[model samples]
Target chain A: MSSERIITVRALTRVEGEGALHVRLDGDEVEDVRLSIYEAPRFFEAFLRERSIEDVPDLTARICGICPVAYQMSSVHALEAALGITITPTIRRLRRLMYCGEWIESHSLHVFLLHAADFFGCASGIELARQFPQQVNDGLQIKQAGNALLEVLGGRAIHPVNVRIGGFHRLPAAGELTALLPKLREARSAAIAAADWIAEFEFPACEFECEWVALTHPDEYPMNAGLIGSTRFPAIEVDEFEDHFEETQVHHSTALHATRRERQTPYLLGPLSRLNLNRDRLRKPAREIAQRLLPQRVIHNRFLSIAARLVEIVHCLDEAIESIQDYRAEGEASCRYAARSGRGCAATEAPRGTLYHAYEISDDGRVRRAKIVPPTSQNQRQIETDLAHFLPAVLDQPDDQIALSCEKLIRSYDPCISCSTHFLKLTMERR
Target chain B: MNTHSRITAVLGLGSPHGDDQFGWSVVDALTHCRRALPSIHVRLVKLRHPIDVISWINDQTQVHLIDAAVGCPIDQVLRLRCKVPTEWRTIECLPAKGTHDLSLGTVLGTAESLDKPIESVTLWLGPAQQCSPIQLMSARTAEAVDACARKLEQTIRGAGPLADPNSHLTPQSVPPSARAGAVTRAEDFDGEMPDSRIDLER
Candidate 1:
């Protein structure tokens, strides 16, 4: 004889956007798991059709408030590639600095506010703050420092208006860039403290075998552009992304799940993947911290992602300060370019993971086609796969406990449901 | 009262979509009517999200937050004076569905938790229906925006609350003596007002 029970979390809390989780089990055997993203499909692709190429950066920046820089960087790079425009070295350095701000802002928010509470068994960051006020305050200060950089460079913190297809509408004055150094330096100390603090959390001893994918740059940690590499494959250019990977629609989600085309296997992205691929490229301070904390070529435990995020935050602050100290006005705010019919695609490492943008532009400077693959969608299938492996151990607990455990696992990925299909709810079933 | 001693920040929180732009419209109206309240040094900030309020109101002693509210009547205004951390959680005007999951109320709670130097907060809310197609405010919403903005101007001037029995700005608009201190519930003032707290963080 067999008994059946079902567990459901009507709405998930603490993560960005909306989403839900469901698991079905039969007599202690995990049958199926689903990370359903019900957030309505924002037809940004269709919206870009026939729009001016100049509008691409600002328009795509609207996709996610938390990681707008990711969208802006990817769109501008892809459009520049399409128009065959090359940016100056100074402009390239400034763009990297802007990305550093975003990574700091985003990673700090996730590590302290979103994921930290899960470790302490608290329901929300506010709850965790009651016990660790100083830590929470430090986190907010670190996040504010990042926002300071974004405000100066990107125009406004959320959905920056300064970025254009070629470069920027205006370059921030040298004083404006230098003024942020004090706060950024403070934030650097906070990030290091944060990494040390998070390293103490007892990460659940659950490891899974998975392929990690990220952009690989020879010189520095990859932020803007590089060869797309995965643990399973050597490398592929951004143009060959579609050939190697494909997105497929699943019945339960509005977000399309992405998998490697040849192996038809799920892949993971975000800080863990970035650290595994580019650990040696990290700045000395961050690399030293990573060595002390992780000391592994590859980490399979998803929960240690918070550690990776803090380490990256340290690296970003260091890079941002260096870029500001070496600042110059250069020749022009932007590179001059002519619109031509061409197809181009580019990928950048978003705070969350790799963000890929491809565009087909006409001779008239209008967008003919557009495709954007946010990292959350690429990791959706892998999230479900992780749950299947993660659920059996927690299945003996009450439904609510199981639900909370599942949410903890999901939050480790820091899935932005709004960026993917949009929202989340969780449910579990037994038969 | 010396207005300069009290630095006030007037924050209009809105996205540029349909009626949702009420917060921005109010800030714009306030900026245009600055001459009327010359005695006060008010910082008028237009913000896209409530979380931004944390950074925008860094040194402000008093803050007036105006935004479009769902679940209320179209033309009516809901007012709340936030004095404590818990008061912010009860005022259910902000949405938590987006990527930035921090609602206005949650952000206020967070602000207090982070020990931000915000002494007092007064919220002016007008009803909202749409959020898309960009920058198109309904006529009713526009009227509500002006009324809310005028009320804020009067508040900034340190003028005592004025009574208008026919006004949709009710309860708190009457007087502090007549209503409960700061935390005025819509149900306490008008029977027709929908319990606007229905959609709060479920």
Candidate 2:
């Protein structure tokens, strides 16, 4: 019998947050594969125990610098639901547009800066620029355009200052939105061009057959709001999340690893999952591109995720342009929500995947408890399984090549552990 | 053509691993004077890569590329102009070479080869006291921040960029009166010192 060998990868690079990999080979038979996360969890739930409901947005925004809007959107929606308030159509469209901007920005950054570096043989974006200046510029420009959308809709890029549970604090002027038309048009073309560009790069042969889960919408392409389900499962409202899923702090990773309630195995979420699960949900140019380009309908194959993400970029651009044309500036930016004690839960399709946020609030509208399950944490097991299974076949390859493939596979999920759990809101009163 | 464009530019550089931000902090000193320079069509670029001074620039246009440069036993800032007569437009130690990037570089280089004029350039290098992923710069290199700031101020008054090499160098040169925690280089202390050299200056 051969000796068992354990190969471990520490501090995975390029993905949004942090995680590690451990592989144990028992005489060639894989014994264990763990995609461990060690990033310090802020325990926002514990911290939110006594915070006013109004502070939920601000507090959640601190959870991630990348997807603050996702958190904000869900949190406000949850609060509105608990308070028995409903927003107008204009606010909803605006919110959707803002979320679209996030999808564009986050996707661009991950695709061009983080993931592309792995394909191009660089440790970081700073390293990638030496070889390709215009590509970098194009990427950054796309990113800036997205950021511009966020700035106009929300307040800033990092921690957006606008938005509240009832509605927005202030709406954009007609001219401000009109000015974005040209940029949005340019972005629409760029998104398609970018999709074409990255699709041509040779992706490694990688695919997974595990269960894929994400939010699904009837009309929209599942952003900021949706019903959670998997390719093998039925759609369920946000309230049913805990009934079907479980999140536990595992020994391998710092982030709370999640799995199905009855099963011991982990599942996949995020772009690949959402794209594959909701392929029929996509509208127009995005749908056309996906139909023409995406490699089959398997989300398990990590490489296909690039095509999936590009398709998403195009979808966001088309949606944004359409939303911009129909935007009207006269709705109450927010509804005055009165604080009340209630158990609130929400599910929104973050740029990464289906993100769930739950809070138990006090009578004064203060949060008594909070719980969040990010997409990456749920897909951790799948990541390790992919790595463990793929390594032996390519063991003889150069280290750089192996590392590149591994990093690319990891980035394909767009693992946003922190931003996956964040949100942003503001208010003038204590509640 | 009787008229010639006197081009001027500024670049910001640093290793994501080092407190290389100081190299470009000079802009803060000149934010008050931006309009004065823009009237003449001066371009100011924010560069995160250390060695791309040649490729991202017009070889004939005067340039100022700032970054944490590797060299000198003690930490100190230095300013170097393109003195390499041949292939002056080519940057040193490029890190990435993907097909798309290579094509992009080729395009830029071809543009230069077609007489795009790329010779006049300056690099204001902020020395890394230590290059460790989590290490801080040497005391001497940290000290050069003030001197570099002052030097940049003086140069901006001349309506152009300037470099003062060795402004931050050895610890022995650091005055006893000054302290480590006081300067912008505190990040040097916060980050881990890297044993491996950052390659290709991407």
Candidate 3:
């Protein structure tokens, strides 16, 4: 009989916020593991109670600087639903383009800076650059192309100021699209090259059983719009999401933990989920790339999550350029929205995974009730599951090495703890 | 990458947390004096780890690093302008590699590593009291940010292109408006609220 050993990583690296890991071992038998969140939660929902809906996008963007696009998209979409307004086709496309930019920016940053750092045995992206300057430069330029897309489409790249309830505050002229052609072309090559490069990375063979879920659309890879669901069921509508899933709140985090209602377990969401659930929906070119890179099958190997992200980045860049080329300035900048009493739910694919927000707004437009479930929340349980399973196999590795491996596992999801909790606590007493 | 040159780089740090964004508050406080000076081409670079400093810089020409240091006193912001008079030492990179994967400090380290000619580099670290992983800044940090911005403007009034580690150069006043297009813009990116805004509550 083999004896078990245990190790713990007090904190993880290559991620947005802070988290620690704990494991139990018995004679080489992996037992229990808990991924603990140490970062303080900023009560975004609580602080948002009295604020005007107009400010919600900017405020919520603070949830995760990395995934600002997701927060803005979710909050804005909810507001649009609550106000009962239909935005223009151009506006819809514009939002999608902005989302594409975000995905590209985030995914490229992760592949080069976080995940690749792990495979290359480097402390960080900066360290990785020393060994490979051109690779780092390419990654940066790729990131810049994504940022440039956001800058032109959404105004400022990070926490863009242009996206509004109806459409952009000011739409760029057609000329702007041409200016991006050269860069987009360069980024296209970079994305493909990056995918090929990452494909060459050594991946540990490990797999787990968790439900894969994401938004699915009939026409294209789901981004700004979709119905909530997983490979487990026909795609469920957004409002029905509550019926299919549940979030358990605890003192450990301001964000709640989410589990599928049917399975009472954490369902997979994010790049891998979307890729597996909607592989066919990717645009023809993107589909061709995916076909070359990924065989037609469900990838449960956690390390392949990086591959999924690269494929998605390529998908977004292609769409971003196409959307910009098709952008027109004819539509009214915005539509009038009146306050109404109703419940609204909206979901968007953040760089990491799925982000959902539901709000109850009064006739006067004040938020009556709010529930935000960031992608990271849904994956927290899954990460814990992976740790529990992984501990037994890698018990002999150095503690730091083990911790880094675990960090890579988590980072594969690109957890944005900052996005998961957006509110800051005042912590004051009248006394 | 020149790992040998002691080039100086200046980084202006501020927090978007609450009003702590006021670290950029001095944007408007300093009056524009020399609007005619042509904009200079800076190797605007960012990196995640201090180790990459040598490669990105190729060769250093006075590098600058800017960021908000957490837990600082408000309105009493200090901009420590000094040259790291020693050879490049390996420094640990900040977590999240900084908000942008492209951190100013990381780039400099790369420049120095490649044997670039970086005469001197400066870090503009504003204090952020809460210093929570989130960007939210404490009240004191906000005030300090504004004070620091103002002080930066004052210091630059006679500060010329800093080339030597010990040279005392006069600042050539450039009108803020002329400094507009991306350059001379603060990394903190504080200024008037955007002229155009989307009605977020559609």
Compose the digit string of candidate 3's lDDT tens values, residues A236-278. Answer: 8888888988988755555567888777787778888998988
Q: Could you tell me the C-alpha RMSD of candidate 1 in Å?
A: 4.8
lDDT of 1 by residue, A131-186 (tens): 77878878888988988899999998768999987788999999999988999999
Q: Give the per-residue lDDT of model 3 (tens digit) for B160-194.
A: 32323353311221111211000112223222222
Candidate 1 similarity to native, TM-score: 0.91
Q: What CAPRI-style quality would you assign to candidate 2?
A: incorrect
Interface DockQ of each model: 0.42, 0.07, 0.13
The order by descending DockQ is 1, 3, 2
Off by over 4 Å in 2: A4-12, A117-136, A296-298, A396-403, A417-431, B1-202
Among the numbered candidates, top TM-score falls to 1
DockQ: the better of candidates 2 and 3: 3
lDDT of 1 at A417: 74
For every model shown, what is its TM-score relative to the native structure?
0.91, 0.72, 0.81
Give candidate 2's error at residue A371 in angstroms.
1.4
iRMSD of prediction 3: 5.7
